[model samples]
Target: MGNILSSHSPSPLSDANPSFHYLVPHTAYKVFINHRGKDTKQSLVSSVYHNLDNRGVKVFLDKMCLRPGQYIPQALICAIRSASVHVVILSPNYAESEWCLDELLLICRTGAPIVPVFWEIRPSDVRMENKNGVYAKAFRKHNKVGKFDSRTLEKWKEALRWVSLLQGFISEGEQGEMVEKITACVARYNEMASRQTI
Candidate 1:
């Protein structure tokens, strides 16, 4: 994982209208975290969420952001769509979870900018796996049941490939450093976006 700051020459979230980082004002959350909860929820993700939150950056993690209900909160969808940025924590089983993959599919559909954190995985691995039958069987099942259109799966893969190319911080040996960098990046983005409106 690579952590790049404003000096990053190739960031979609930087330079061009960087100050236009406006997120939904209806909620306190500024970032929508898309990750497989079982993978990083209790560990790195939680740490990062707490770090950002402590620094006054609200993050939308499902457990904390979701309303109390048996069904997925509609607010969660709104949060995803309206959030200024999406921090997608990519772990080994990220692709296997229908929940994670479907949320990713939705994030891609929104055309929102993405910040990918590859934890214990490589960019090439994500690219290669997504290109293959990453969620093929589940997609086929969803299609067969008329629950979802499999074509969107292509969009999700495409999104994964695109984000994998971005210079996001990778966490392998020094997870703390990666988390620090990620928190800084999110804070900077929030500052820039908020600046534009003022």
Candidate 2:
């Protein structure tokens, strides 16, 4: 009779092979832009996209790629998950659109970093505490479905200011200050990737 045998967990490195353990290719950092399609012309979203693209940043803008007859929600979720960053272009009408709110909720739930540009609106207008504002209403409705707090809002604001510097929106005298912040963020991401490589 064959000897009785017991199964054992494999060693952590048992399946490791040189070819399989080779360095993963560094893909271009993708950025997904969430904005109202109607605001494409003369909107901050368009301007920021242009600036970043000009600087060789890879960005995914819906207006540039959304195909007709396609399911937008699915396409957007795919893009958001694939992206390294999500840029939300906030305007007075932004909260009025269910699609924009859905996109924001998805970004929040996915734990993807967000950069919210307050275009023609104040930060207070986007915060959840402002119960009477447009953003407040949207947030109130959103809270029923998911968790989002002021900290998340502030994080988005920080990201926005951080990216704005990279786009050269700061004054000539204050440009260095902004550049320092943007460089720090870029350096942090690079360091994270280096650690993963090791």
Best TM-score among the predictions, by candidate number:
1
Deviation of model 2 at 148, angstroms: 18
Candidate 1 local lDDT, 1-198, one digit each (tens): 112111222211112342333343235457888898888999889988999899988788877765543234345566776777789898877866656765665676666567889988788777765434434444455457664344444554566676789888787677788889888888888777677668
TM-score of each: 0.73, 0.54
Which candidate leads the pack in lDDT? 1
Candidate 2, residue 69: Cα displacement in angstroms equals 5.8
How close is each model in CA RMSD to the real structure?
9.9, 14.0
Q: Tens-digit lDDT track for model 2 on 124-180?
A: 565534568766665556456544455443343333333333332222344345334
- Quote the RMSD, in angstroms, for model 2: 14.0
**Residue 14 in model 1: lDDT:** 16
